[model samples]
Target: MGVFIHWAGTAALLAQLAGAAVAWGADGGADGVVAVGVEEFLGSTGDSAEQLLRLDLDRSGTLRAREDGVGGGWRLRGSSSAGRIDGALLDAQGAMVFNNHYADADLRDNVHAFADDVVTAITQGRGLAASKLAFVGSREGRRQIYVADSDGERIQQVTSDAALKGSPSLGPGGVLMAYTSWQSGFGDVVLKDLRDGRERTILSAPGTNSGAAFSLDGTRLALTMSYQGNAEIYMASVSGSRVRRLTHARSVEFSPAWGPEGNRVVFCSDAGGGPQLYVVGRQGGAAERVETGYRHNTSPEWSADGVHLAFTGRQGGGPAVVVHDLASGQNRVLLARGEEPTWAPDGRHVAAVLDGALVVVDSVTGRRRTIVRGFSEIREPSWSR
Candidate 1:
């Protein structure tokens, strides 16, 4: 285990003192770690109904539920053949907490929402069971944006641009995705509303416009554009107005990731003679280099807790997933042979491209498991919040 410290100046110091810093340690068994063992919690339900959620689904799309970790079986909560339950919540005695209905084709997604509520109630943590992932998959002879469950099930293509697409980032609520596409013969930033099938070209200047990343509030986006004759970092409202340049460097900048508090942005730039990590104010100012001692680093992503950042870095050979602890000022490899690291809502597991497929790995336990594959290639995975 190796630790590297680089003070990010007064702003970073203030943020750390405000309780936004994340402490990093070599011990993988920390008590603060969130363990998302769906098989353990769901498959090994205890006799208590106080902190568990029971679910039952059949081939007919009928669903039932229970609360409090009861193992007796599911209650006749609802049914859906052509429609689906919009939302659901249950209390300890298998009683209704909340429920809604939806007449849409995305029945599974609706169920996921309800499950998320149940998990939150039980663990008081983000529901990894219900979170989603957005990535670029070349399944149809062209790279396009695809969405799937965090487990990589229920995969569906969200774009058919018949061109290249990459860098998919989920918005604040996981309700939208911003990505880059080459449908216009030049790189363009596009937004897709996940709730409804609506698409909007957010940035399409004469030059390259790519690497779209959404702030924690979903109100602003940080991306890379070359419209000013050089690749620079820019921030803009989701509506495409109030565009502000954040980095005015001569060296090219790309892959801007919004910090957890939405006040800072970390990105990749060659201003340090090699592609390296840099952090700057979201409003734009001097860029501070992240002294990782690596030859290259890119694809920066902030953990949900804002305590750590994950990016691609390697001294040689292929890039690997690296996590930098904001609190401890330490960085370490999470995955030995993966890149494009994106954090699960719990911030314990990371989704990355490994061997031409998408895999989720527990950074603490060092457990690596494949989520999905079979496409010609899958890269740039963005786990939903």
Candidate 2:
């Protein structure tokens, strides 16, 4: 076999690590080597609730989750089982000869291998920690909620139970949050006060109620309700109880995002055959096409300055996060593979769901990095207003 052992597979990972080191007589010799072993825990259920989140490892060449010799809960906890060391020497031939050393049952060998792959992964595209963010995730087979810093620090589970909860949309000034919860038989929108940790029910109906967004002045809220049959946009006073429908369409029109101007709202509709982006006046009026191209433009989020609108689009190829420039009437693809493109409060960057992980991106630079490798699926990551 070759000096350096390169093995990658869903089941071949563990065997290769242990086998590689022993073959090179790296068990215990003159020059010891660096080794590493790493394991990841996916989401697990009732007694064990049965919520299981698949590990979506983003790797190109040859990468797969190793399940042999590792057994436990939803975690990357395991012992370092194997090790191998490789070095270069000045041989007689002008070319450098690669030497391979293998260690038998070395604790450090697995760690060394882990480190090599981890470093290589980061250099590829995985970002280093920076800012913090709070999102919802399911654990132990239950649909709970969590808040983690943007860098995956201080991860705290906010809600504990089997009921579904998430879509933590921010308010105008970052003082409040509007989210949806299925604690009841139907989905209900709730307004949360960030200061005193108080929550109040804003709206509830018979159908799916979602996409709660606060207006610019923080005086009113725009959400989507399906009480009238199909989902439609609605405007409700921030502190008052009066609610009015903004659209009377017969199609499934929801996901209302308030525009920066505070006088208009953009939503997604399938009235024209496939799903597309549409705009309507705040008080209610005829809807206009805001974006064109794909029939699957959904989850519209207005930029802070309201110059552009970002939404999800699915062409024949795959799903992508795109931005629609209002003046130019052009659609720009920000991410080649992602969904739910939500603009930050500053509107300079976007937080999108890429490969089942949330990633922050600088739209102009076309660069992205992972936030953390947690959660089964992430959607509707809104910025703190």
Candidate 3:
């Protein structure tokens, strides 16, 4: 059985910042903190367009989620190319808190971003609406990488390679993706720029070269290569310059996940008699085994706060997604029917492939939901920054 642990300090800080709201009293008047109504969104703001562009509370004031039990679910009613948006903000009480006119070309993305910011302001929770996911799907007859919104709304193909391609991982800031492809007749680590749809070969070593993950700052990458006679972990800059070997063990090392601060990395290795998660410093050091009760563990992913490690755990039945708390030495299984778990930007949710479809689970509430379906088979779904 996994032990329960209290939330860390960072989460507490976020709560304090986000829940700093002031509600109204029985007198139908302003109390200690002024409560802004939905009318603020209309009526005589000369710089309404500018306020919509800023989207910050200081520029347009905060709004509640509902007012008079009429309208809720803050949204961007309309927008244009001038960076203007007719936006809404709400508080935890479902009261209308703020609204303004705004302009922007990509209204959908802007609305999601603003919605996330609003949610952060009201609930102290990290906003993941603007985030995305990258995964491998065999829907096109061959394994290929694909991209989708965090909620699995916009499913788009990232690579159209008619060859074997898998192990998709998103780079820092969600601007790039690195995956292994056999289009060149051998396993090679390929980097694809998601911004402009550009592709480049990062590592085409003689032997197997796969399992690539980006560092926190997107400056470096950690991947496994057998060019040195054994499958080992290596670190290289994003430019493919300044290459350095990290692990020299005889056991195969792959699935390199950089810690939040980028000072250390967690990877799967058989150095301890079987495949298990191991942590080593980025510079170089002796690897220490991560304590867990499972007989086998692999596909480890480090949380953004550097306090948790999520990976696949197997006992006698099948594989399950498990999260281990680093600070308290406590671990918990997040999902009993999934693999290749990846953390969202908020660090509160994890996405994995379950029953050949993409599913997401809440780490705190234990709520499971399917985000993407209809794929013949999807694997290695990675959430972007």
Candidate 4:
């Protein structure tokens, strides 16, 4: 038997977690202190579920758990019975705000779903607690693809190629994954069905094939293929049966990422004498430069909302994660030192590699928390929708 959870709430918590002083409400008031009660469980499930829920809320950047003595705001309380956990959200006056239930054979999955629901009810925004991440990690001196929950738990290796692999991209809902592998002595794009553990070489063209990205619809892929003599951005069917070249630049073009609408692709190129960002249509056309005011920019990932673009930019002679507003043309550095950033489903946070560990950063508040570590080297984290 696994764990189950139920919760509900009416009022929302609009607070920002910053420094030691916690502020709640729209005006950053000291009132309305939010807290998560320790969950009571039967058997030996322990308090892991409660701890996970608390961590999820804290990482949201919109909520924090106040101490026991703190008063006001809403409180989350729950208990378990026969592997079933029932919970509710109560107002400061001890009145019920909301109630709901969740059941899954996997305890972690149940907790993640519950956390996501709580975040949505309070913040009116999507929660990444249940999202999935795919990245490249080294094992036995060989790099392979790995997957883990958004909280960096339940880590699973997806590939055992025993060869170098990189550029991992997860499809919509995380049912499919695409990555570049060197098992054939050439960079080839391999697609894997995460559920059934089945994989196939999707793009095995001569020269090198890499930088594969799934479209918003997951029906097509945009990648950089050099089989045409020079590396250029190309679009191919998910089965790799039909290929359409999208870029013909003399300078090498790679790291293609799909726009939110699936009609445009943003990629990195050295055509401007230095690595920079460019956008091209899905049907193939002249690329236009995306001025980031930086000498070097790469790994452009569009936010789910289609309003912002996250990429790696050179700052202070080191790599930094930068977010560029497509509408206002304003660029802000999210991380002082990080690279290969991928946006969370909510578009409010980003995951990147920092000092050989995976760190999630709140793009709005610039708050960072390390989620996954102890890997030899992690690179190119791709978050599922």
Candidate 5:
């Protein structure tokens, strides 16, 4: 069973400066005091747009299940160019007991089918990282990104470059993150591979580019690009090439999120007046408004089962997390004052930013607990495969 751990520091609010200090370590000086830490002991802002592109996921058949080396399970590494897929199933000796290959496009459909084939043919029945969650955190300071156990433990920061970073979204295996950072002193989108901390510049513009949503198949990405002018939705090949603008207008449109079906995108747009929820097709068409008269409602996230939509907005006392059921047309408030609601892959509960820290709340019971805390500012979180 997973459990929540509370980690707190005696450092008072007046000592908040120490938060950044220990996070940075002034001259590597100052005797180590009780530095503030995340309760989970883990381990955002802004926009920039330029024709400027930086990081990318490499979608042009850059990778597939390897057919040679050691296979059975899809453990293929990412590639930048097309090549024969090679892999194998390893015993204790790391020898190739299983291996094969097909054209990349041929095995693209129903990715899960191949995954299951591997699991059943090899490991009996074990799920891939498909059931994982990943997010960026400042828990260890310096704006480093971290991946943790589903319950937020075993926290590991994948990036330590110390550049301001935020808006991390998980791809197929949850082993990579697409985010915006100031590493170049200019806002740029980059893809960070969690395995080795290697980064690829995907999109870097003058102002800001963020909100990367991986397609259900993990073959494409839907994101908000401000390079042209005001933020608009666009489709980009995962490899960072072939960027196709999907929206064209003067209104502010951003925070593009992929629907469970993978063919639609739900995002927050002021196009509806005061920033309301809107849904558009993956191919980009007339956006349909989902709400009215709420003054403010942003962050539309579809549930795991695609039955409900959870978002944050001020419908009452303060900003709250609201779930909208599509079939029954029911509106349920999961928690008040919640920001960045990321549904667990299983949809059993949602990990939300509550009271300025990462918290998980029961969708039905409304009970909540702080899983990550003690940071100067915490916001804009995403879930992984």
Candidate 6:
């Protein structure tokens, strides 16, 4: 059997046989490698739940699931009964770390909760299992807004506008969604409440209004509008009132994304003769170029920790997903053939469109898997925090 070793901090963890082990923090200052073992669950939905939890844990990249015969550092056992799932996490010495009963209405919901709980207990970091994604999907030659779980399950169409829709952005907690719709013969920003199914035109400017993004706090939005004759970034309240202009570049500015602190916004501009990334204050000021070393970049999405900025950059005559470090002032390509990158809640993974399919990519290891596909076309994905 081959052995794999991974180094973290000052220690190296070994993965034995065919199973991989990852190092994570434990309670009481104990830090070591962890390999989780799963036992077959019993009940009506037990089999499906077990499979899903294992898949999610592996996809997290923070831990691994042990094979049937391989020994593990922790054991996960669960059961489903009467529309509820009971799950428990135990250490090697049989110490209980987590034991909870999830009463979600759907099996996928319960599985997501259990998987997120295990990841949090082991790594002390946020989990992406429960996150949702909003993107533009085409059906019957018409584009519409659609929402689905991070795992590409429970997909539901959010809009029925048969005209054209794009640039779907999900607000905090996935409660509200904003997108650009061409149903009225002009590109306008439409805000929809996912709970009550209420739709309202948030920005119906004369020329065009598109690329709407919600603030980190979900109270404000940053978008592009041409009502004033030239495309410029603008800020507005969530209710589409109190509108304020953020950028006044004569060369055109669009695709505005808010920083995690909400004090600054990054967007794409052609002021320098090519589409480049720039940062401007929320209150409007002189914009500073981000210096990505790329002649063209667009669709900027800030990480949850506010440390990295992911966007689409031109590479090899095609669109590539690139991440720029804010502090180190460095840029690295995450995907060679993807665009319109969005960050997962964990900030370590990104979702982008590759070959007309939505895929989730691990920024560190460069591993990726298709999460949403089979549509006529998919683009502009937005992940919930």
Q: Model 3 over residues 1-385: C-alpha lDDT tens digits?
A: 1222345555654553343331234211242212333223333332453243333222112233223322223222223344435666554334556664434455545545665566566546556667789988886466778888776877888888577888888876678998898989999888999979999988888887888888877878898888889989888777665567888888889898898888888998988777888898988678888897788898998988788999999987899999999888788989887898999877778998899989988786676779898878889888886
Name the runs in model 3 displaced over 4 angstroms.
1-104, 122-125
**Per-residue lDDT for 1-385 in model 1, tens only?**
1233344555455553332122111111244322111211211212121122233111001122322222222222434443354344443234565566544455555555555654455446566656778988886477777888776778988887567778888985678888887888888888889889798888898798888888877888999998889999999888775589999988989999888788999999998777999999977889888777789888989887888889999787888889988777798888888989998877677889988999988776666779889999888888876
CA RMSD, predictions in order: 13.6, 15.8, 11.0, 7.3, 19.8, 7.1
User: How far off is residue 279 in model 3, in Å?
Assistant: 0.4
Instruction: Please give the lDDT score for candidate 3.
Output: 0.72
Instruction: Indicate the worst ten consecutive residues by lDDT in candidate 1.
Output: 56-65
Which segments of candidate 2 are over 4 A away from where they belong?
1-134, 150-152
Local distance difference test scores for all models? 0.70, 0.60, 0.72, 0.81, 0.60, 0.85
**lDDT of predicted model 4:** 0.81
| lDDT for each residue of candidate 6 in 104-221, tens digit (9 for 90 to 100) | 8888888888988998898888789988999988877878888999989889998885777788888887889998889899998888999899989988988989998999899999
Task: Give candidate 6 misplaced runs (Cα > 4 Å).
Answer: 1-33, 69-72, 91-93
By lDDT, highest first, what's the ranking?
6, 4, 3, 1, 2, 5
Query: C-alpha displacement of 266 in model 4, angstroms?
Result: 1.1
The number of the candidate with the highest TM-score is 6
Better-scoring candidate (lDDT), 2 or 4: 4
**Candidate 5 C-alpha lDDT tens digits along 68-150:** 22312123221111322332333322244455432344222112222333343443433232244556556544566666654
Instruction: List TM-scores for all candidates, in order.
Output: 0.75, 0.63, 0.78, 0.83, 0.64, 0.87
**lDDT-best of 1 and 6:** 6
Q: Could you give candidate 2's per-residue lDDT for residues 311-351 as a string of tens digits?
A: 88988878889988888988889987888877765464677
Best by lDDT: 6
Ranking by TM-score: 6, 4, 3, 1, 5, 2
Whichever of 2 and 6 has more TM-score, that candidate is: 6
